[model samples]
Target: MNSTRMRITTIAKKELVEFVRDWRTIVAILVIPVLMFPLLFILFPLLLEAEAQELDELIVDVELQADDLPDGFQSALEYSSINLTFAELDAVENLTEPGTAMEKLRSGEVDAVVRVRANNSTWQYAVLHMSTSEQSNEARSRVLLNLGEWEQNETRNRLVAVDLDPDATLNPLQWNGSIAQGDVASKGEQAGLALSLFIPLVLAVWTFSSAIQPSIDMTAGERERGTLEALLGLPCTRAELLFGKWLAVATITAAGVLLQIAGLTFAIGYLATSDIISAPTMTLGVVALLCVAVLLFAITVVAFELALAMRAHSVKEAGSVLGPAVLLILFPALFTQVINLDGIELFWFAIPVVNVLLALRELLLNRVVPVHVLVWMVSSAVYATLAALYAARQFNREDIVTTLS
Candidate 1:
């Protein structure tokens, strides 16, 4: 066993040397994960907030079309942030034309058009703006922002003119709204919902992509470069050679996963609430679960990819087979998001990639079921070991010398 380990270690190191020599591998495994989380979590939100502020202060040109304007209608319009320009109805090309007002709004001639028609004591209003246009949406928001205040103020004026009590009428049945409190989850836990859905989606692609070039380069690529023949000449058993190469791939993939987790820790720390950290118990457990699930999944993915790579006649063939395989994970990952965890069946835990993703989401949400985790790990271990063994067996075949398959 010691001799086997030694041979494996030696082979693994040799493969790692190639990784270290390649700058792209270093960047993919190290730098990208470090930089990605902050840009996604921190920088993007700040940009959105800045844009929202700009929109709030924007001066929108609004065209108002109201029939028989009320006594204090202009005064109520004053409460709105929109710059009420009051463009004429005849300014339109045709009164009978369908969507004439909408056409002007869509063409950017007007930011928004407000139509107010009074019937009995009710005033029905519609704000017309192009949904595709940001400025138009902003203009519509500005008009609607103080709608309640406008109604109250106009009602007060009308009531006073008719010598009636507006307050009594408005306060006839005032009710208050309060959120129902149950099953309080920490902000970290709440954040986990989004984290699980989106994080796994991105990580799946990253993990697969990170493993691909290296796995292919070590397999079919080595065959292309005539290195496989030389490597095959070594006395080390096929299992030892496979172990070494797999360890090298696993090391890079594991490093990328660890760095991503660390980056996630730091980036999520920015959004931290509830005692400068999440619940200590939950956080640590979730982290442990994530490591186990993801590492096993990575092991399985890399093993299968390496096996497929060895079977391919060339690097291009391997890529064609592997690239679109992401859809297999993508479809299930998307499906799991809408699925209620409470109703999930135990059989799901036996599935390979899907099991890890679901278990990952549960962990992130701080919902750790021991049975689920155990099943996922055990099943994943089985798949990963089988995949690795299959890859090693490919090396033992007589046809492995050249791309005969």
Candidate 2:
């Protein structure tokens, strides 16, 4: 390596050693990455599934009010975890009257109320429940499910009553489902779609986290400790010193990201071809895109962090400035998750974090266009360069002795 590269390396090595010495930092940088993916993708989903099953198995009390019931329809109301209580005539009349049932539902007099009355020649059914109540919602679901079964059974009975075969006469529609991929291509893209859903957010968030300590500690921490002043008195120019420290912070942040990606890879491997990833994907192209995106994203974030950190006199102050910065990554990631990519305008690539997110999603989805990749790289590089220049300029001021130049 040249003298400049060698100097940067020396500084980076020192920073990494000091950072790794702290057990808590080690856990944040190393352990959390390995553990986070499994917990987020696996344990969380399992808990939600358990909650759903619990809801399905719960016994909810419901009051049934029926005036003219269809033949054998009441017998079909048995698919859910509901405790049925036949309502008295006065109670039935009060429930069907209108505003009174909602009050009874809110007051917990019943989990849900079901009403069936004659609509001229046919039966009309209604399920009333408090939308805010978990129990009431469950009861409502059960009632709807029972109604669905009864409707089907009643239709079949109607055909049988006409001396026709219920199976042949009652059902005429035929349907089946499969994916519509126009031609045979790598299923890898579909797999990337699932992974891409979380990876962009992961890159933005963890990249911020990984940069925080090293960036703040190198600048504010050193200044507060009086080491920065003495170090500035060395033979190197302000640019060299600034570059060296930036290199160190970037290195540590990248290392942490790699560890986190390794953990994410392990979790993905464990879940490959499972329900979580029905179309597992891996290719050299996918790997290439991921690395490019990660590096570009890291460059922009590290420079931003270093610039802010250099201006702060204390690590706490630097932290406070950069803490809410994570939300900059978070909300966009969430918003982009729900947006239809088909209508995404070309101008979106000009926005910073949002650009990275869109690029990652598109790249991972194998919708790569050469122009889009070029735009992402060019914009990111320009942004990174500007931020790095600003950070380096901080050293030109009397920053070694004071917070401002």
Candidate 3:
């Protein structure tokens, strides 16, 4: 037992020294993700807000018969600061036809067109059009306000004509909607899902990239350089070597995951506090779940990467083999987002990366995951352990190592 511990400690120290000495590798592991999340989550929303403010200005084209417009209608349009441009009713004879008006609106020549019917009644119709898809919302708001004023005037005229009281009760109805299932997830849940969907992908990338290069270089790269044989002849047992290498990979991957989490937490907190997003506060419980999930995810990825690395002749070859595994880790997490399985099912918990993402999402939303979530976590850990053991067995084989060298 002491010998095994000493061997593992020796290998772990060597791995740490190699990792720290490579400045480029260290930067790749730490800097990129730390910078990306803040830029994506924080600055992107600010840009959108600026664009929305710019979109609020709209121009309206009015073509009303001189007598058809009510007394206060034009004044109302002016009061709303709708940039009203007028064209003679005949000047737009066929040019201002419905289709032409629509084309003009789509082309940005006008924000909206108001056409007063030849009948001098107060029942004239207005159609507002916007060039840009985003500008349509602002156009709709202005159109609705103008339409409401017109409706009110028409209602008063009818009341006066019928000699009826304005306050007489019309169709009286009351309606309400309620859900009795467990406390319905608020908009906060949706926001949480949105914030967390990329977390799994981020973790996968960090784990694979941070561990893959070093893991391959530690094993396959040493083999290519003829240094692995010397180390193998040392009195180190296979389990000790594997444990030490695994520990090193886990350390780097875990550090990467921690850095990613730090970046993500800062970005998310900024967004929530700034009112850009309506996510709930991440409690200690949720943070604990996230930490566990990230740890397991890192171990699984590092194990898989080392297994592939052990099979390759060189670091480049190992990278090629492990590239797909990196993409595969993203799948289970991505699948969680695309699949909306019922929360009560135990089957989903048995799945690997998917289970972790689902559990974390539930935690963030303050949902109590079933006890089976722990069972699934244990199962995933078993799977990762078995993979590491299998890789260690491969490392113990003389023929496989010789062929790679």
Candidate 4:
């Protein structure tokens, strides 16, 4: 037991030295996420806000047949922040007949053109035209509200025309229900799920990248440098060496994942406070779930990477073999978006990366996950352990090691 501990400690120290001495590896593990968070969370929102602030003043052309329409109809447009310009019949004829107004609106000289026909009664129809779909949609919304007022006025006119009293209809059935207020924690949880959808994907990328370099260096790089042969010739048993190296890789990978979590948490919190994003505060429970998820992901990545590294002739070859694994992590994230959690099957919980993501998302959203989630998490951990053992067996094979050399 003492011998194993000493071997692991030595390997861990050696790995740490290699990691710290390499500036590129150190920066990848630390600096990239720290920089990415603020840019993604803070700068992006500010840019969007700036763009939204520049509102184009809409030019509206309204023609009413009646000398006076109800003030409510005009007020509706005013309330919607529309700038209305009333046009005389002569102006409408010149604009529409010559198609000058339509051309102006299309040329960006005018925001929108609203045409009211000469036969405008309370049952009048208005036509709006805009160059862009977005502007047209907004103009349509404002015009619809004005049209509603026109309908109301038409109804009132018909009531007066028919000599029917407006107050004759009595309401017998009433709806009197109060809305239940939710606490901040509940609201925060709702917001957290929306924010946390990408966390699993981010975690997976961090795990893959963090594990890749170390796994390649420990296996293919060691063999290329003739260190593996020297180490194999030592008094230490192959099992002890494999265990030590695996432990070392797992620790490094886990540390990198932890750094990513910390950076992401801080970035998200900062951005939320700044109103850059609408993420919830990171609670202890949320952090715990994230930590566990990351731990499991790290174990899986380390085992997978080590196995690939053992098969490759060089670090470059190992990278080529492992690149596809990083892309595979995106599948869980994409699946989370496409697959509704409410429709999740119990069997899905047995899948490794997918389960962790689903469980963490549920935790973030304050949803009560089933006990099977925990059961699956335990199963994933066990599976990772078995994978590590399999990789170790591969490491002990004489033919494989010799082939790599």
The better-scoring model by TM-score among 1 and 2 is 1
Using TM-score as the measure, name the better of candidate 3 and candidate 4. 3
Tens digit of lDDT per residue, candidate 3, span 240-321? 8878888888887787777777788788778878766776556677667667766776677777777788888877788788
What root-mean-square deviation over C-alphas does model 3 reach?
A: 5.2
Q: Give the candidate number with the greatest TM-score.
A: 1
Model 2: colliding residue pairs:
none
Residue runs of model 4 more than 4 Å from their true location after superposition: 55-185, 224-227, 271-290, 337-344, 365-370, 399-405
Model 4, position 245, has a per-residue lDDT of 72
Q: What is the alpha-carbon lDDT for the whole of candidate 3?
A: 0.70
Task: Write the candidate numbers in order of decreasing TM-score.
Answer: 1, 2, 3, 4
lDDT of 2: 0.77
Number of clashing residue pairs, candidate 3: 0
lDDT of 4 at 1: 59
Assess every candidate by TM-score: 0.86, 0.85, 0.73, 0.71
Q: Write the per-residue lDDT of candidate 4 for residues 127-154, one digit (tens) a residue.
A: 5466365565556665676777766666
Tell me how many clashing residue pairs each candidate has: 0, 0, 0, 0
Which 10-residue window in model 4 sums to the lowest lDDT?
59-68
